[model samples]
Target: MGVSGGSPTSRFECTRRLSAADSQCIWNAIAEIGARVGDRFTSNVPLFNCFGDHKMAVRGLVSARPWVADDGQEGGGGDGGIMMVAGYPSLREAVIAVAKKELREDRVSREQALQLMKEWLQKSQDIKNGRLDDAFILRFLRVKKFSVPLAQQTILKYLHFRNIYSHYCRQLDYLEPPVYELLKSGYLFALPQRDKLGRRVIFANAGKLDPYKYHNTDMAKAHLVTYETLLEDEDNQVLGFNHVTDLKGVCAAQMTLWSPSELGAIIKLGEQAVPMRHKEIHFLNVPPAFRMVYDFCKTLFSEKMRNRFYLHSSLEELHQSVDPKILPKEYGGTIPMSEMIDMWMKEVSRKRDALLSLDRMESQKVMHSYKPRTTTPKASNGITSLPGSFRRLEVD
Candidate 1:
């Protein structure tokens, strides 16, 4: 998963002043949590995330209420005192736009494209190892371009369905048939019925149930008669036979059938190994956010630069160096400070070592177990067979 975001931690300092020790404690807590979560899902998948303007939003640093610009412009407030314009789109839209732009440029060769996808798969292996640097990501955004493919669009549709399934219907059991029918043929099945209150009610008959009930209705009246009449006069037929003989064995006096165990043995031996190299890549990319947090902490403690100067300068530099191509309005990172911090902390806690150990245990249960093949033989075609003699191989 290719994650792109701000410097893993808020750029804004806490409003309530903290002593050096307090600051260090908070930083340590953040680091620990980040490390834990990053390790947990590092081998899972790539999550190509892009940062938004509100990257500096952290609890005790920003307000819960949406920030309003001093200029009275709505939706323009952000961390580091940056004010957005009214026309700016949300972060999701921005990321989508960037992805589209990347697709449009067509910079990557077919081979390179495959390689890049492989890298994403590899990055899903471990969070800490898989984490990307902000500068590196910025460079990648500058050079690499992409478009949201049809597969991603399909995924988005599924995600949207999952999000709003409750609002549109009682449960998913009733929704899939109609949705699939609509997607496939543009026409939907409708059951013409009436409620007790005399209100006309229409339910999807996408299950193809009770075709006769729809025969006289307006929906079926147009073509049902023609179809039924045509089917009745159809040339469909069936053949009957008492027994069958195998022509291939006609010359042979006897034949031997393969055992189920033998077939299973052959299949098992022919199976290819599951691709695990990609898991390594995933492991490498997983902990990028935590690494960012760690690096940010290190920057705060640099001996060459005063901590105060480093903090102010780093924030200002990032603010001024925003690339127009990868702008927040085109990608992500616009989460409010408080919400961002809350989400990070929650993710950290949710993916702790204890939870991950349980996950690992569960995964082991579903993994296929390999059993060695035995040389045992069984009777075939009601004939007991010898190990290797020609007399043992017989056909009826």
Candidate 2:
């Protein structure tokens, strides 16, 4: 078990801070949950999570809706699920295989990789003591398709970005006026339930945003903060995530905030730096008035990015792809949208100090030493060799 590093007060953080024995207990609990999920290693492993007073309802993989639970509800969901389907290998086997592959590619065992990264990461002396974990290392590897050198490079760049970015690398004070304004505007939500296919959903309720007060820059930072928190879930690293953005009230009035430079910067961050792999983006309720804005924004998107853009005219159409059960309460689901909003606010509040700490770390000089390879590396994703149906994954 590893201490979670991205968000403040994350259960991953809480569990990570636990003494070795307690952290082992959490792993024991995980094994127990996996056992109860089904017969052997193929069963679904569920890890229930809590955010402040909220109990995130989760299944298949670890995903939490940052909100207080509905009245009287305990913090868990049914585990009669399966992680391995059809004729695939067990979950444990999958992880082992990936680890082996990474070792073979990098010419180092898991322990060696961890030690190497620690040496590089500790050079800045700005990170928390013993914050690096196997899962953290695995994410970098997974994102870079198991290329050790590439993953190492991404790790450095991520730290470098935080060191330089004004709002990130610990300089982010959630209590700041800009942060407060972003929270009050309600630009994002991580739904309480995974989609029918088990992918986590991130809802960008652009309609709920007050265009005059909503800064696109803040929106991008909000995404980083959210990813930092949610990516703490180890299983989510494998299960992946999808996004649904509603551009309902977007108009020329709001377009004033859409700076091309700001959009491009975020696009690069999402594609090259962020560790999570997104499944898709469903842009529902896109207003006709927002067409000009979308057109300009589309230019920043590449063929890969544009291909995932889904524009649905109505809620029914959107639900065709996304299960309504995991959608916001206003969108015909059991989830409480207000609670999700409240959770996001609390998350921001808790992470402010840690974020600010990273902001001041200044890794510009350190990055030069660990710069990633110019030669891109992408390994075989789980199903490339398999037959038939597939899940469409994208970087949001």
Candidate 3:
């Protein structure tokens, strides 16, 4: 049954008489609120919800038993002691008592109480590590006895923080323009796997007939447009200018001034653009006037993206114009598409052959190691030497 602790009197306990369905509805309402704001504290805080009374209640409820029968009693000595034991104070009860006392005394603020709860959660974790006593009921009782007001404050503080944090996060999401753009474009998808431990890798199925199939051509065009639009919306003139620049001094060294919306847009766009299906697109394809803007867009990528996208010749050419070493020797010192593909295929085949050989060797080893119980011992008795214990046993 649902119980309301905050309000005085039994009349406020709506769940007390609720049916299963009604109880579920009430719980769902609470959970819905929790889902939105729960991440703020929980995402970074490790021990946020560990030492709660809910856990103790769950443990007690799951393992409770009726009193055992006396040596010569009828019907297990009248009501099985269930009512008495159930009525008796538990750890949770003691904690509640202490929390109440503190509340009456005004010994702690609601925020302090919440901090205590967080501390208690850490204590619970310590218990798991054998650093503290694991007596759940006893611990609860002790906490209740010593800090009733604090406990109450903690509960209130938690609820307060949850509500506040949730609202704030929602507001942040609302203010983020890129998020709106993403939602509008319906381009949201799972981010790609990271490459070379630092670079991001996006996977796409671009078989022959698709209009955007060429990784270097069509996909690049789409990314260029997307990057430009994202930059324009931010009103970030520096980044905007960089998006079109080719020179490192113009694109990388010069700082672009952008508003908060522009900065947020840049961050979000960088994160979002990393997972797009193509990597070979180049910013140089855009006119020289827009090269700074394109470079600014390129700069937003993580190291992985830089590595992958830098592989494109248009990108390399732009880089080489600024610095010759920027493009690797593979693709005319920049690898051709056919040569790159061939190199990738050879690497794949080499690895595949190695794996097959390793597997075959492992299989042969397993077969060789197999022995029948009927076979003679390979080793002589204690007086003789053998290569292994099994060989010695076999010889004997």
Candidate 4:
């Protein structure tokens, strides 16, 4: 096999023959990834190539003949070329790169930011028993562009929101009957494929759920836990998200699902509490009547988010905003909706333990009600005991 450069990172050529068992293993893995390679046999056929996790392409190359080096030396004594498997970078590495370039994050800044957060947490009376790990702190820091004060404020606000909406935020166990049923209902899910800009797309079908069966609290828990699962992937954090809501079958009754205040709270949560960026929100197949509800929601969005909000009358218009290539077939894409929803369910299952542990989070009344005393209590310095004097001395 020979190694060469190609459009996607680097390309490798394989001029070596593999054992039947090895070939079968490769075939199985390739098939699992849903890529097509003509024959299963390793007869100089290109095995498979597919991109995963933000443009990291995995390709297989096989050649029957021995490969010669550029310097006239044969690879492995002219028997065959070395089989090479290469990937661009892991999601963590890619996130690091993105953080450096976009979030102004590096070792020095990260340490400094985390230290500042540590100090803030100590003095904070708003958040009690809050998460103090680097991952939790860095989430806010990154969203605030590493401004420690801003991140601190956001954390406090987030905890405060949860405090006020304990019904929605507390005990968010995905395995719970209500949450599990809502998740299985296919009402809301993250698309298997990311958008063109590598941002995760969360699809919500407003009409998919039965209003009588699933309440707003159930919907809230399901969506919140799902977002938590998606955010575990660093790619989603840095690149942010694109929310696509299909209002095809949304009825007037469904519009009344949430009270005005409740609806506002959800919108505010996305803007102020959540650490992920709202790159764009595409509302597709909107009925004329839904415009009133959409307008109400729009009023709740921040000015920055308001700019990213878009309404699409058709899938064609949606494709203009979001790439159709990554969308499911029903939405004018190649992939099937069932497959994408299954992918989301699998992700939820894979992160089952972590998601369930959310129940252990500080869901009880967050200490937002407490206010820090601005004036420090003065220590008594008026009295002192003389050295070598074993008796108490009185002083004015």
TM-score of each: 0.17, 0.62, 0.18, 0.70
Q: Which residue ranges in model 1 land beyond 4 Å of their true spot?
A: 1-87, 104-319, 322-343, 351-396
Using TM-score as the measure, the top candidate is 4
Displacement of residue 352 (Cα, Å) in model 3 is 39
Question: For this target, which candidate reaches the highest lDDT against the unseen true structure?
Answer: 4
Per-residue lDDT over 1-396 for candidate 1, one digit per residue giving the tens place of the 0 to 100 score = 112223223323432355556545543443344344431112122221111222223222222223222333222211111122122222222233433443342225433544554465244332123223222222222222322243222222322322222122122121134332231221221111111111111111122322222211222221121111111210100000011011221211111222334333322321111000000000111122233322433343224222222121232243332222222221123433333223222322332332223112111111234343233223333443323332243323
Cα error, residue 110 of model 3, in Å, equals: 30
lDDT of 1 at 15: 23
lDDT of 3 by residue, 28-53 (tens): 44334333432111112233234243
lDDT of 2 by residue, 181-277 (tens): 6655667756645555445577886766554565554555666766765565544565567889887665443443433454566566556767776
Looking at model 2, residue 45 earns an lDDT score of 23
- Which residue runs does candidate 2 get wrong by more than 4 Å? 1-112, 119-131, 168-170, 214-216, 343-357, 366-396
What global local distance difference test value does model 3 have? 0.28
- Residue-level lDDT of model 4, residues 204-274, one tens digit each, is 88778665566667777888887877766544667678899987776554433455655765677657987
Give the range where candidate 3 is weakest over 10 consecutive residues by summed lDDT.
233-242
Q: What C-alpha RMSD separates each model from the true structure?
A: 29.5, 14.2, 32.4, 18.9
TM-score, candidate number 3: 0.18
lDDT of 2: 0.53
Q: What TM-score, to 2 decimals, does candidate 4 have?
A: 0.70
Q: Judged by TM-score relative to the true structure, which candidate is superior, 1 or 2?
A: 2
